[model samples]
Target: MPKITELRGLFKPFTKPLHRQWKYVWQEKGKFNEPKLTLPKALNGRQLNIIDPLHDPDPNALPDESTPWTSPTRHPMFEYLVPPLPREQHPLFHHDQPVFLFDSKTKLHAGVDQACLLTKAIPFYELPQSIKQNLDKISIPNQDDLIQSYIRQSIAYDATKEHLPRKSTPLKQHRSFRIEYGIPRSRQMSILFENILHLCESLGGRYPDLFKRHLYRNTPFYTTYERYGEPIHLRNKNSYVLTSHTPLSPIVKRLNKLEISSGEKNDEKLSTHDPDGHYLMKGNDYQFLNMYPVYPTIDLQPEELYQDGDELGWRQRKTNEYVHTTFYVSNDELIHESTTDERLARMVMFAFGSALVQARQQYPNGNLIKPVTVQSVFLLDELFHFVVFQLNTLNYNETNDNRYNYVWIDKDNYMYDNRPSMVMHNPVYGTERNLQRYVLEKLKYNPDVFQKFLALYLQGIQGKKE
Candidate 1:
């Protein structure tokens, strides 16, 4: 590994220009208008198994004669919760509750203006197998230009790798997949309800409606499930079909009537997925406004809206203030010790003010909107969350006085700290980071991946940094 000083020196010069270039290129090409080049689906073409439960023995269930063993347990009520109840709960409800607390949905109401957290896995699975197989061979507009441009970048990075000690490699930064769904127009609003009806028809009962009603009733609320797959299973599983006599909401019932043709029990054309097995068919439906895929591109710094005096330090202050407000500071003692509603009021003001300053510094002639400028403020929360994770991973929880264990003082009187442990410890986090790193290493050595790291870090900061 390179020395910290040497790495810093090597990285410092490239930060500003690279930041400008990344912002420009990413913002320009990240929009829906940017034609997504198609690639062949990988898993879509497989001979997916959709076994009938009646035809085969229960795969998910444990054999009745199986012995049960106990393991060490943890949790507040573990001592009282009794041991080794049964072997039936094989698929244990071991959910990451902490992960759900900082879910993407929470950020929607926060100041994260127009963000997209498109899971590559979901899109990759949704495409047809035939289409995915031919992805590499597909000829799409602007695709070649982008690839060529990246290739040239890679060649340059390869030539200079030794001096720079490149931390990231070049890889295809942009990917797109195609989706095709032919849902009838009338049934568009009630897709969930209609899907339940199909389940009932297939299984010869009115059962699918229970899950639909449950989900519908809990819409726009914080809900939890043992598994994300449970919803899919409830909709697709053939055996042990769930039934409910629950009546649908007026809107759903009307929409269902409109969608079904006279005496037509099924709308086969619009549906996609294995009839014999359960696997989610993922894609954006262009035909439906609510369900359409939002291929979004966000402008981090709108050049048209810029103001002066915005520097790195100012940006930090602005970001801090935004985080303080967005997170409910319910602790009365913390607020009472301070003389001013100053802390709360200062939060939004400083964030917006600094954002304006930062934007103006980048675009001297641009017009800055105070509200939109606060978008950068959203990034600060994610940053703080990372800091907490770093501290926690280092066994330095802030709730205790040992927080100092995670901090180090630099010669410049600056505090140098470890990148948060949050990204390192979580399996999902590790997976994403590893995939990104893999892609980076594959690409020609460049700062683009680091920039992506920073962006995602900012995103995490906004949602979870608090």
Candidate 2:
């Protein structure tokens, strides 16, 4: 029990005195849990003293100003100088490494609404009709056999999955624990990618040189973008898998080759004259989405502005400079949920951002350089979202630069549906028959999707450039 003085010191600054707390009743147990009937309900039609009557000549009739909550401010008998409540520090105030390590740092992840805004790209939802028509032309050697083998591997991976450390902590924060169910998301992703890569490798004899490219894990691809006079930086420290080398050919021809009128901009063409959806409030950009900064945005001084494109430890001499494909796996993490539309947004932004970085590395001075292209594959839930971005132009100029990047998004792709396993593995649900309960049947396998994946992979392998 706290001392009366201590209790008062703690809560009195923020709370009101008993008399000042009008209309609030502390009914005694003597009342046997029944609420005290003060007066007839004012809004009730049958109440005799109800205020619905037309006459208002009762001059001496005083109002119930003394009732609870009658005054906005406290109705204390004597006013005294009340000190404001003491402010407390964050839970992890003493944490050696804070969430944002540097001063006034903003971590902008690739997201849906800001994808077009960040990349300054023209979005062609789904693969273009031309790409679709060309899909049947690019045939993978022994694709059916490969897919079956791939499916087998995928199932095996799924059936064999076992939880390692089933629970973990937040990023650098202590004491707070997070419980993860089933196989870890990272392991599930790894298994999925491993299966895909293994399947891809099975064709090494036929396309030997195409398999020469390397795959990197948990790589960081940090880049900066300026939006609405604010420099937003994205330090993608957890890019699941980034396949480098193997140049990609754009589905459409380069912007410089095509003769587009100087009077027209791609964004404007997409937006028309209407200010809707994305353009609903231009001055209010991402802020208008109702998703603000996780913590209060740190106000920085003028001196804190950075030199922007500082590629971390990625040297120019590295042979595998061109980013071929990036694999991202998203789930219901504490930070962001992998919703359908949001996943597409992430894929587009990730593709464009990676391409921009690659472009900057190759053409430092903004001289004559071929466009950089990046393909992003995002896996959320069981669905796969594919995005291909061709970064045609970047900041040698202003916001509405005529030369815009081209992006194609196809998010309605799932490799294979989950299935009930006789191979009895991890418990996916309750204590019994978890596998049968959770996994979806594998009957809904889509061969065309993986074919498209292979097509995207092999597009420019035939016509490789330096």
Candidate 3:
């Protein structure tokens, strides 16, 4: 008993404060649990006022004549000040990164609005009639209007599938990841050339002359050797094996040709994988409509934690919820020396953005809802900045033979140095080095500016930044 008393004495100070806190908590909880009397029923159809209305002067009354159109700035209570903006500076800060603002009164930066306006400069139906007609002729009625339809008809499709639905292109649906040779070796190059010519003629007959001119004249022949810096033999081979030492030009070229062929014909054969050396083997046809495309597997909602005597005091996340779907594309589609993974990632982003726009329009209350744009890029370097650099990097000098040197050249005359030669040769080596350094440095550090540049490119003439 004497030892117990000593221990109690030692704990008295801590116990006193803790007891007080418990009492306070209980008092609050007691009131919460107790029932309050309901207000007396209104008598004689009159509303009851709990407050003295005369003293309050009807608190909801509008401001009097002294108020100004805009509220005057009040002096800060704390001894701190906001930095003033420069006279020439725009209102936005770090415009490229995503930002969240909860204030209802605040508006989106004018530049964002301008960006949206730019997309409208080009209409959905502005494509050439040949490409357009081929789409209608080959693709399902719904997808005929898409850019993918034209690409499919021009590049991937064959003559047989005229009325088929877009049951997933080989680009998206090939189950086994194996490389397959298309057409016999004797007529491989010949077939590609003929296909290109045929597509051009078909496009020319159905589309406007302006479009035909671009398609036939500007578009390169459907040879893998002419696109990526790989040999013609590398086409339809597993990229991992070939790209280990070979440049990507040939593989990229071949896949591009295949894509165009499929697009033009809308044939199911375009999506087939090689089975027993038969590249065009008929495979299990899985319908996109039948497939239940699932959203990303993530629990977007935050877990709730309950305290002893309180409702949630705060939420951890404002909007972490998102939906994502995975679609496959042929690694073959993205072959070639010029085909950086970064560029491919950018392509994926663009496709998703376009799809998001369509989805927003289709959903209920979409106009009023501002959805967050979230995407994962497939290629490592194909961020917005990398995409811009690539677009600007295209050689505009069509007359220069070496300009297309980045493409794969024929190996038939390997002894003759038949490979593509460097276009930027210099009599003085120092000048060439300096120029390369300047361009390389610019791309490395200041890529955000280039991203802005490409964003502007996506805009039409009416889309010039104000």
Task: Please give each candidate's TM-score.
Answer: 0.14, 0.55, 0.18
Candidate with more favorable, higher lDDT: 2 or 3: 2
Q: So what's the TM-score on candidate 1? A: 0.14
Residue-pair clashes per candidate, as listed?
Answer: 27, 3, 36
Give lDDT tens digits, candidate 3, residues 301-375: 211221111111122233321212111122222233333322332232232332233234335353312222211
Rank list by lDDT: 2, 1, 3
Root-mean-square deviation of Cα positions for candidate 2 versus the true structure, in angstroms: 22.8
Cα lDDT tens digits, model 2, 1-466, are 8688644433333377755433233222123454544554664675354332345645445466666433345435423433322333333233332122222122234345455655566665676444566578756577766665555444333554454343333364344323323554455556666766666656556666666676666676656655444555555544554454655655544343223332334355434543221222221222323335532123222223233454533444456646777877654442243356655765665566677677766777865267677777776434677787887776633745555666778877866665532212233442223442344333456678777776666555553333
All-Cα superposition RMSD per candidate: 37.5, 22.8, 28.6
lDDT of 1 by residue, 1-466 (tens): 8688544433335556877766765665555564544434874667644434434555655345676544466465765665644434534333332222222212222121111111111111122232224334323344334433433333222222222111221263343322212222112213322332333233222223222211111111112212122210000101111112221111001111223332344445434343211111112211111322432211111111111222222122222222111211111212133322222222322223323333444345553222121211111101211111001111111233211111101111101122222211234334323433443444333322222222221221111111
Which ten-residue region of model 2 has the weakest summed lDDT? Answer: 97-106
Residue 352 CA displacement from its true place in model 2, Å: 2.0
Superposed Cα RMSD, model 1: 37.5
Q: List where candidate 3 sits over 4 angstroms from the true fold.
A: 1-89, 94-339, 362-418, 421-466
Top-scoring candidate (lDDT): 2
Candidate 1 segments whose C-alpha is farther than 4 A from its true place: 1-310, 314-335, 339-341, 368-372, 375-466
